[model samples]
Target: MTLTVRALRAGVPEDAEAFARTRRATIPYLVCTAEALAWEAAHAPAGQRLHRLLATGPDGTVAGCADTGLLAGSTAPGHGFLHTAVPPGQAGRGAGAALVAAGEAYLAGLGVRRVHSWVADEDGARRFAERLGYRRSRQARFLGLDLRHAPLPELPATLPAGVTLASVADFADDLRPLYEADVECAADEPGDVDVGATPYEVWLRLNWGRPDWDAGLSGVVLVDGRVAAYSVAQTDGVDRYWSGMTGTRRAFRGRGLATLAKLAALRRARAAGYVHAYTGNDATNAPMLAVNRRLGYRVVASEWRHLKAL
Candidate 1:
């Protein structure tokens, strides 16, 4: 079938839905919705320069989608991200190649010095990136948990003194505390770009404000009345639950607060009828990987970071 490429323009509601559907098919481990995708594109910071594209087969179905932009969270400059995905059985066509070419050209025009992409370590995706002058770097894992059957850790019947479990809803009156903890946690995360500089406003818009974000299910750990750790929960409006982000402050690292936060969130999600849970982790993040393993998460898929000098 022949293919055509075009920008995923705003106000075009169908494109968002198509992209979301294709994303679900292309990467089942992650949770995404049309509303969340549209909101992010509309609310992203100006510097983000978020550009989205869609590839349509001759039959008028969405064969693939791509997005590229400058990394908004990094304090440094000239670093951007690229990702192009096509549905299963649609590879070998020109859709993926065309999308990457267009995405790279757009970012390069913006003077992006470097571009990064995550290529799934399967189905010749890594080879595809290599063909495009992208070199493999660090690897990451896509983890999944069978929440309906997996034996989750039992929560302690009694809480430690001055400690409490809370949710994003608990801090509806003030989100800065959560933002502050997130900033600190992101600083230590291993990645090509530093995310410690994510602005409060951008966090509010791109993260906390997403339509799929479950404020009531997302758990936070409190120590002496201060936010110490958090687990952001997102759902697909069905039974699937995904951990958007989970992190613990440096001072609270050894205390298992991050684990505590995730446990609380997962328990709440399972009780609420969610059957599956998914999360991603940098392969080098031993602490989080150990936590996931103890909690029965397995690496269902892996992807490697690929970089190119524009």
Candidate 2:
């Protein structure tokens, strides 16, 4: 039962795939792929101290994995994040503990004084976080929709006046407008962490450059030539698809623009052969939750944001 926890060797395809496998086993609601994992490791913003760790058993099998780092966009000092995943049967083997210890030590060395982690809202997960001195802060639900079974909304035959639906690829030449809209929407997203205005360069690298980001599947709503609402889509290039982010600018909130944008994105995803669609939202986001519920997205899992002061 001997185990070793060490930093993941970036650029090594095998290690990246193993790490992705562990994540998928532990958190299936979120999308994970070897290419996406490698991209995050290699393209993380310069200010964010990214550390990917792997827990390996004596047989060289990956028992668990962790992604930890400081929130580079946070204006508040000492804010850090650590998310660890250990498949069900591997929990008692000390893999979780080893990863947590290593992750905390790594962040602490980088001057992080407070760390945050998201633990699935289950008995064992809560107990583990409590034992590690983390306290619950907020909750978020993971929702899933079976594109092959559930009925989706039909696209309106006529477009609303001054409104047009388009794919993200249409803006390939210039994404500034989309970025501006995203920054505004992100600031209003419910969460314990305040990721203040995200810089265009950082957003471009981490989000726009993501391997799973399918521009054709991403939908945007423009009002009189201005971006009003948009949905970012991510896929595993298989059957799994994820709504990376769906939001509407404050000025267009109550017009159902967000819902329209998401519906368009989901339809595109289904047409593209993606069978499973998933998204996550904070429990306090009633509007978004209602929108997902109406779209037949059922709650599959929930996680509690846990905070620990170092």
Candidate 3:
């Protein structure tokens, strides 16, 4: 069976649908959708040099999917990244290899000096990437909480003095506070690369304006009317929920504000009938890992970021 690898065609709803279907099947812990796929393709920042790659069978079935581009928002340059997914049943047919090859070539052509890929923290997946010259650099765990059955920690009858838990929508009139906090927290996050200061407008378009953004379910902790900690949520408009990010400002750590924000978000999500809640955390982030542990989120799967210099 021959698998054709090429850039995914824009405006083709079927290709987007197939890519979403294949990605969701490959990584069940995260949420993906046809609309999100198309939106990402159309809205990528110019600096990102993003390209969507698709592998299709002779019958037009999507065998695998991958996207390659610069690590947009990264402070340092010459860093590229790719995300590849192949369905379980489609293994061993060279679909994954073909998709990754196309992505690397595209990035190399764009003058990228290095490429980062996230491979599942599994024996076979690691071996595959290692064989292709990618060395594992960092590990992140995907945690899932069964919202239908997990007992979320109780919210205090009254928030700690000078603090208020509010829906992210409450700050619609001004997002600069949230954006500033996000930038600070992102800089401190443990990762392979440092992110440049993303303009407020860029952040607004890429993060706050994403199709999956759910402001009502996202929580922000305000202290003295300042954005202190926040939990961002995304939904499939159905039962699955994703914690896009949960972070606390450096000035407001050790106060349990992160926990407070998460509880608010999870409770709101469960009440909205979302059954599963998912998030990812760096393996070395003990504070956040502890916060998630106390909240009943168990590690469901892990991914190792593998990097290769071109």
Candidate 4:
């Protein structure tokens, strides 16, 4: 069987569907869609050289997919990502290897010095990544809440003075506050790379405008009319809810606002008929991890973010 690697054709429904299928087969907990894929390509920042690579089988069917790009948020130059996934049962047939090779070559061409990839904490995936010279760097866990079965805890009542639970929709006219909150909170996250230089317009296009973002269910905690904390929700508009990001403003620490916002969002999501809620946390994020654990989220899977010096 002839295996060919080529650039993904944008605006092709079949290609998008195939890409989503492969992603789900490889990482079912991660929510993806044609809209999200297309939006990413269009809205990615200038430094991020995003490319979607596809591998075709002998009969011309899409067998694997990879997304390679520079991490725009990284403070250091030359940090890149090469995420690859093949249809279940198609791995090791040269599809995964070819996609990895193609992705590495593309990033190297752009003078990227290091590449990071997320690999499922399983034997097969770890072996594949190791074969490509990727080594485990940091670990993360994917948590899911069975929204249809597990009742989300009610919004906490012990909010700090002048604080009230609200939704992102309440800020329909202006969302720069939310962006500012995200940038500030994310800057403190534990990771190999630091997220830097967040611009309002970039946040608008990449985060606020995502098709999956549900402003109505995305809960925000307000203190004296200012955004104090927030938990953004992204849904498939069917039965799944994903916590996009949850953070509290720097000055608003020590108030259980982050947990309150997440609980508010999850309660709304459950009421909206979402059967499942999913999120990921870096292993060292004890505060957020504690909050999620309190909300009944259990680890469903683990992934190691691997890196290789190119």
TM-score of 3: 0.98
Decide which is better by TM-score, 3 or 4: 3
lDDT of 1: 0.90
Candidate 1 lDDT score at position 163: 84
Clashes of each: 0, 0, 1, 0
Give candidate 1 misplaced runs (Cα > 4 Å): none
lDDT of every model, 2 decimals: 0.90, 0.93, 0.91, 0.88
State the lDDT of candidate 1 residue by residue for 27-133, as single tens digits: 99988888888888888888889999999988898889998899876767889898998988788888899999899899989888899999999858977888989
Q: Root-mean-square deviation of each candidate, in angstroms? A: 1.3, 0.9, 0.9, 1.4
Rank by lDDT, descending?
2, 3, 1, 4
* 1-310 per-residue lDDT for model 2 (tens digits): 8899989997899999999999999999889999998888888887888999999998898999999999888879999999999999898889999999999999999999999899999998999899989999999999999999889989789989999999899999989999999999999999787778877887887788888999999999999999999999999999999999999999988988888899999999999999999999999999999889878899999999999999
Tens digits of lDDT, candidate 4, 64-175 = 8999999987879999999998877887788989998999999999999999899989999999889889999999999988988885676655766788888999888998
lDDT of 4: 0.88
As a whole number from 0 to 100, the lDDT of residue 51 in candidate 3 is: 90
Q: Per-residue lDDT for 88 in model 4? A: 79
Error of 1 at 48 (Å): 0.8
